[model samples]
Target: MTALRFPALAGLLLVALVGISRPQPVAADTPAPAGFAAFVDDYYAALFAWEPNQATYAGIHDFDEKLADLNAPNITHRADVLKKLHERLKTLRAGKLTADEAIDAETLDHAIRAELLELEVVRDWKRNPVVYLGKPAEGIDMLMKRSFAPPADRLKAVIGRLKAAPQLLGAMKTNVENPPKEFTDLGLIVAKGSVSFFRNDLPAWAKDAAGKDKKLFAEFEAANKPVIEAFEAAAKWIETELLPKSKGKYAIGPDAFVKKLETEEMLDVPLDKLLAIGEANLKRDQETFVATAKKIDPKRTPAEVLATLNEDHPKPEDLVGATRGTIERTRKFLVDKKIVTVPSEVRPTIAETPAFMRTGGFASMDTPGAYETKATEAFYYVTPPETEWEARRKVEHMRQFNKTGMDIITIHEAFPGHYLQFLYAKQYPTKVRKLYTCGTNVEGWAHYAEQMIVEEGYGDGDPKVRLAQLNEALLRDCRYIVGIKLHTEGWTVEQGKKFFVEQGYIEPETAFQEARRGSYNPTYLYYTLGKLQIYKLRDDYKKAKGADFRLQTFHDEFVRQGGLPIKLIRKIMLPGDTGPTL
Candidate 1:
C-alpha cells in the first residue's frame, strides 16, 4: 500500500469541485460543525507529521524531510495520542453534522481505530521486521519517482531520509522481537534488495536528479553511505541472528483477523461463513475454467490448453513494449463498448519494474495520491525475466505474459482498472474518503473490470480470453481460501502453495509467491471478496434501475463514490437497503 496523508476538513472544504465529463455532487452543501472540523484538521495534521512518508504520498510536502520515529518512547507516546484522539472523536456530536461530515466522521473513526489496533494490538512493529526494513527505500522511492518538486528540492528530501535510514534500521535491530521465520525471510528480501538499490540503482537516480551540483552529491554520498552500510549490516543480522530463532506466530488469531475485517472493510461475517463463500466462488470458477478450456481445444486438458496459450507470448526483450502496445487498444475497447468512462486521456507510462521491486511483483499500477497536483504521471510496471536466468526459466516466466494473460493483466492494472479508478480521486465526496480507502473496494473494482470487459466482448468472445479471465479469477479465488486457511485453519504455507497449483491452476513460481504473501497479508482475500461484492452491488443496482440502468452510469457512479467499504458504498448507492454484501 502507498503511504498517504490527510488534510483538515475546512482546508478540504475550500477547494472548488473539479469538473469532470459527468460530475456528481455527492457532498452536502452545508459546512461541517466548526469544532468537529477543527478536530479532524488537528488529527490529520498530527497524523501526517508523525508519519512523513505517508505525507509525501498524499501529495503533502511539509513532512518530506522526516522519517517515522520508531523509538519505543515515541511508539508508546503515539498510541497514547491516538487513544486521546479516539476519545475526542467519540465526544463529537455526529447528529448535528452535515451528511458528508457524518460519513467522513465515521471514516475517520474507523481509520483511527484501525491504526490503534495495529499499534496496540497487532503490534507489527515488534513482530514484523519488514515494517522497518521496507520503509527507507519505499519512502525515498516515492520522492524519487514523481517529479513533484525540482530535482534539488527532492534530493534534499532524499538526503534527509537517507540520513534517517540508520535510525530506522537501528529500530529494526533493537525493536523487532521473534517474528515468524516467514517474516524474517520477507524482511531479508527487502533488506538485501535495498542494499543493491542504495548501492547501484539509487546513485544513478541521485546523479541524474542532482545534475551538476557537487555539494548536493557530497550530501547525498554522506547520507547515502550509512544507509547502504546499515542495510547490509541489518540484512546480515536478520540472516544470522533473526532467521535462526524467528519462531513467533504469524497469524493474528481468528478473533483479531475477524476484527480486522470489521474495522478495515466493515465486513462482519463469521469466519466459517466467509470461508464458505470463498470456497463456493472457487468451485464455480473452476467449473467455468474446465468448460472454457473445452471450447478452446477439447482434446487438451485445461492445463494443457493454458500451456498452449503460453506458447504465444512476447520475447523478453519486447515485454515492456508489448505491454505499452495494449494501453490505447484497451482504452479504445472501454470507450467503444461503453464498459466504463475513461475520464482522462492521459495514459500511464509502461515501464520495467524497478530492480528492488522485481522479486515477487509481476505487473502493477502506481498512481499519484488523491491530493496530488504537481506530479500526476502514473506508471504501469511490467517485470521482464532477468538476464542471468537460464533460457528455459526465462521462457517459463514469459509464459505469464502471454498475449491473452497480458491483456487481462492490463485490464486489471491500467485501462478501466486501478489507473481509471484513481482518475476520479478529485471527485471523491469528502476529505476523509480521500485520506483513507477500503482495500476490497479498490482491488474489487480492478478485478471486476477484468471480467466486465471480457463479458462485454473484448476479444470477440474468444474462449481463450474467457479462460484467461477465469485463470486470473481463480488466482484471486485461491488467495481468498489460502489467506483464510493459512491464518485461521492452521494450514502450512506448503499446503497453500499446493492449493494454488492444483486448485487455482497457476504457475508454481507465482503460487509460491502468492502463498508467501498470504502469510503476511492474511486478508489478501480482498481481491475476490471485493469483486464478488461489486458484482452483487451491480446486480442489485441493475434490478433497481431496470430499463433505465446503463452499465457506464453504474461504473461512473461507483468510481465517484470513492474507495469506501462496499458495505458503506451500498448504503450510499442503495439507500435504506440492508442487503448482505455477498
Candidate 2:
C-alpha cells in the first residue's frame, strides 16, 4: 500500500528502457506526418520542463539546472498542467497517426490520464504527506548510483542540492504544518533515517569518489554539513511541532476507500468481493501451511511446527553473509531448475539501504531504468539493523534476516523475479508498454515466482521450503486485508498490528512496522493480489492449452509481453475483445 505521490508516467518513462540511446533523426519520411511527432515532442518537452528531476534521471541533460517544486502550491500547479495535458491528448485522433506515432499517442494519453487520476481521483497527498519522507533522499541516492554523470558532475549536483537542504526542509515544514499526527510521527522516523544519508553513508561514497575527484569530495563534505544540520533540525521539529498535531482521526472512511479501490487499482470488484477472495486465499494458504507443517513434524500443531522449523533453519553469523548466501542460492536454484531464463546482463548485488531512501518500504530492487546505460545495473538493498535498538529489539530485527526469510526475500528481489522480469522487459518491442510497466504485474510475478519454484520441487524436495513460501504469501494476504481495512474500514493501527501478529504469524515489532507502512501504502496489497492473478492466469492458460502447455513456455510468453496489467494480459493470452479496461 505504498502511496508514492510523484509524477507517474514521467518516472516510468525515465526508467522504461535500460540501454536505449537517444534516437537519431531519420531522413524525411512523408514529412513525418502532420503535427504527430511535433505533438509527441512537445508533450515530452513540457513534461521534462515541469519535472526536471525526472529528466536528470532519464539521462536527458536538457533540464539539469532545475529541480521539481513539490510543495503544495506546486502540486496544484502540476495538477493544472496534467488537466491541460489530458485535454490536449484527448484531442489527438489516434487513427490519423502512423502506427508508431499512434502507439506513442496512446502512451502519452495513458500517462497523462494516470497523472491526472492520481492527483484528482486518488488525492493521496491530501490524505497523507508522509509520502515525502524518502523523496529527497531518493533524489540524492539516484543521482549517486544511477545517473551517467561523472563523479565530479554528480558530486556537484549533490552539493547544489545539499545547499538547498535548509530551504527544502523549510518547504517541508510548511507543507506538513497541519499534517496528521500519525503522519508527522512517521515523518520523524523517516527524517531520522534520511539524516543517516548525510551523516554516515555519504561519507563512504565521498571517500570512494575522492580518489578520482578530491576537490568535488571536499565540496560535497562542506555542502553536506548544513544539509545534515537541516535534517536534524527537521527531525527535532517533527518531535515538537508536528507530532503533537499528528493526532485525532484521519481515515479515508469506507466510501472514499472503496472509490480509491475502484479507480486507483482499477479493481472492478466490490469491497466484499475482494474481502471474500482474500479470505478464501487466506484459508487456503493456512491449510497448506498446516498440512506442510504436519509433514515436517507430525506431533506439533501448525504454530508449534513453525516455531520448530524456525529453530532448525540456518542462522548466519553476519548480516552481509546471510543476505549474500540467500541471493546466491536462489539464483543457482533458478538456473538449475530452468524455472526461468536468466539474463546475461544480470548483476544482482546486495547493498546497505541508504538512509534518505529508507522509508515507506523495507527492501526494493533498483533495476536499471530505461534511459540508464553503462550504470551500475541492479541492486537488492536491505536495511541494516538500527544501532540504537536495544539488545532484544536487535535480536528481533536480526530474526527478520533468518535464513528462510532471507531466501524468500531473495526470490522476490532477484532470481526469476524482479531482476529477471526487468531483463525481459528490456527486450520488449513496444516502447510504451516497456516505458510504463505495471507494479502489479512486476511484483505479482515475483511473488508468484517464490511459490512457483517451491511448488515445482525446489529446495531439494523439502516441504518446509514450501511451508516457508506459503508463510510469506500469508503475510502478503494479511497485508491486503489489513491495508484495506485500516485505510478504508476504520480499523485502528493497533488493530492492524494485531491482525498481522495473530493471523500472519509475524513478530510484534515487525507487525508494528508493517502497520505503520500501511498508513500511506494501502495498495501494497497488490503484491499478493497480483501474484494470485498470475497464478490463476497460469492455471487457466494451462487448462486451455491442455497437453500443449508447458510451465517454461507459459512463463516465457507471459514475461515477454512486457509487464502489462493482468487485465491486458488476459486479452493478450486469451485473444478476445472483451478485455477488462483500466
Q: Top model by lDDT, which number?
A: 1
Candidate 2's residue-wise lDDT over 1-582, tens digit each? 122222333122224333233332222232332465555555555566666565555555544444556677877877776666555556666347765455456556656656666667556555444455555666667667764677667767766666655665766776655565667767787788878778888778767756677777787888888878988888888888777776645565666666555443445777787888888888888888888888998998787767655554333235666677776688787777777777654466777666555553546676555455556456777766567767666565555565666677778877777767667755665655555555567778888888888877778768777777887888888888988888777888789899988887776777887886777666677778888788878877888899998888888888877666676676667664353432
Per-prediction backbone clash count = 0, 11
Candidate 1: clashing residue pairs, number: 0
State each model's CA lDDT, in order. Answer: 0.81, 0.66
Positional deviation of residue 25's Cα in model 2 after best superposition, in angstroms? 20
Q: Quote each prediction's TM-score.
A: 0.93, 0.87
Tell me the spans in candidate 1 whose CA falls farther than 4 Å from its real position.
1-34, 387-393
